[model samples]
Target: MRSWNIAGTLDVVPAAERPDLLAEPVAKALRELGADTEAGVVEIDPEVADTEQFCETYGSPLDASANCVVVAGKRGGEVRYAAAMVLATTRADVNNVIRRRLDVRKASFAPMADAVAQTAMAYGGITPIGLPDDWPVLLDTAVAEAPEVVIGSGTRNGKLLVTGELLASLPAAEVIDGLAKPII
Candidate 1:
């Protein structure tokens, strides 16, 4: 097992070993992926779960953190949803790339209530690990190439440490060249 520590601040343990630290769905997904999944989990203060605060408080590199956002679009009166993963230093291109990929007239971040309700995850901790099967998991190339990244654990009280390759292997995941744009 590799050391999953982040700047010597977070004590990351194998996610399979700390099932209690993950949301039920996340835990279940890890289990289903079998024992070789390269992922870890660490408990955290819910107050610092958001990307900026969590990175600052935990001494985690901002570039080594990933954010998962739920996006929604409507076409022909039907709603389509997807999860977009990008490094914390960038923002997902929901209006153009995502809109075109989703094949919707327009795409936007899903409302907090709708996102949480649909994913059964906490508002600030919607990881792509256990998203609905039909929802595409869009992975930014940068995120997929990162050696390691800190991401939400489906609950505000914890975070997951995983390799980009692990995320790229998730169900329905699609790696894209420019899924996000650097924040200016």
Candidate 2:
């Protein structure tokens, strides 16, 4: 297995902006789901370069990892929340499928910059464990059955790897369909 975490700290941007590495929400969610797992957060080089790199560097199972995405719907120029969990192998199609589900005129990918600021997570590293509770959370039916999965740790340089059973424990998560279909 590839060694996880470089030294002792994760590579946080702005250096000073790094927060204390703790197991608050991630652990809580796991416990709620009956998952007895342990997680460690350490600063490392940016883990958001690409999916391949994310899997390789983190020693993550490429086929089983999950990416928690925050989707939004707009009505009268106002944005509402809709969350989706998709397999790392697939992408979330927000335009055709998710918009109608959210019951909004339009749905779009919230800018990474804005999402980071709002969630206090860097772009490409947002997880669903402790997300804002107001939004409707959806877990792709595909991922709900996996044995284990890795998710974002609210930062780009770290990830919170947990069991799929643990993720299903979240009250807000609703299993849905059409996570993604890779184009050949």
Candidate 3:
């Protein structure tokens, strides 16, 4: 497997060599955002793609792992979508803060099928970096300031190591305070 050390840990390689499983839209967005330099992708055992397993297998700290969740909100018959990124130890404030931010009556995690179809990314591998332009990407202030964090690479078999600044620089990325609450 190819390897390089831009961020740390994981045998990451150039994003251009990203796996075919990565959606085209995600690859295009990564290129357009110049995230290739700030982030690197690494292949992993697909069986261990979940946050807990991946971190344990790769020896990365839990605090350095981030998760991106797709949420849907509706108001007056209009539906809106947003991607929320927060540290794995925290939970996105979907019902309250996110609903208020989306100006919707209700907000909840998007159905698995809808999220996969809309983002063209695998169910457990959505990342904030390449979200659709129209969808607002709400990034928790904590995640946005982390020195380095690992996020999904649009494919379950791959992961990306990136800095908070890199993610915040993506299109439609908005750093929000209290976007996530402590899991405890």
Candidate 4:
């Protein structure tokens, strides 16, 4: 396993043993992508997996945490799906950028059940690394350029730490400016 210096705080473990990532498909994809070494996984209490609590408990910088949200839109009887990555300090432009980019009349966050069924991962732990090939992984420029960021680990029991450049290079990822707007 490659060594990760996560601001000298997070104790990253192997992705295989991540408690919340018991799904075979999600774990296989992570291995195939070499995410174990490239993007290290850190096991944590599932209770603190949510961004706010995770950062606060782990002493991680809030700006270094990114959120991946799944969005869905339907047009002409067909539904399109996408996953958007943005820093915790900002919000995905779901109402504007995402809806326009998906070329749908409207766009909204994918339902919890649908997102879980599609990603085969926990609802709050859907990272962009191993998403479906058909779904676009929208990355905000700020997220793509950050030195390092903490994201989901395909399970609520862990988190994935990776450089923005690495995350931006995933398959089907499209990095765009203004993909997210600052949160008030």
**Model 3: lDDT of residue 61:** 84
Order by lDDT, highest first: 1, 4, 3, 2
| 182: Cα error in model 1, Å | 0.6
Worst 10 residues of 3 by lDDT: 1-10
Best model number under TM-score: 1
Pick the lDDT winner: 1
lDDT of each: 0.89, 0.62, 0.84, 0.84
lDDT of 4: 0.84
Model 2, global lDDT: 0.62
Q: Write the per-residue lDDT of candidate 3 for residues 13-50, one digit (tens) a residue.
A: 76777646355777888778766655677788889889
The sequence of per-residue lDDT tens digits that candidate 2 reaches over residues 123-160 is 67777776767767777777777765666666665555
| Clashes found in each candidate (C-alpha, N, C closer than 3 A) | 0, 6, 0, 0
What stretches of model 3 exceed 4 Å from their correct place? 1-9, 19-21
Q: Select the stronger candidate by lDDT from 1 and 4.
A: 1
Clashing pairs in 1: none
> Candidate 2 vs candidate 3: which has greater TM-score?
3
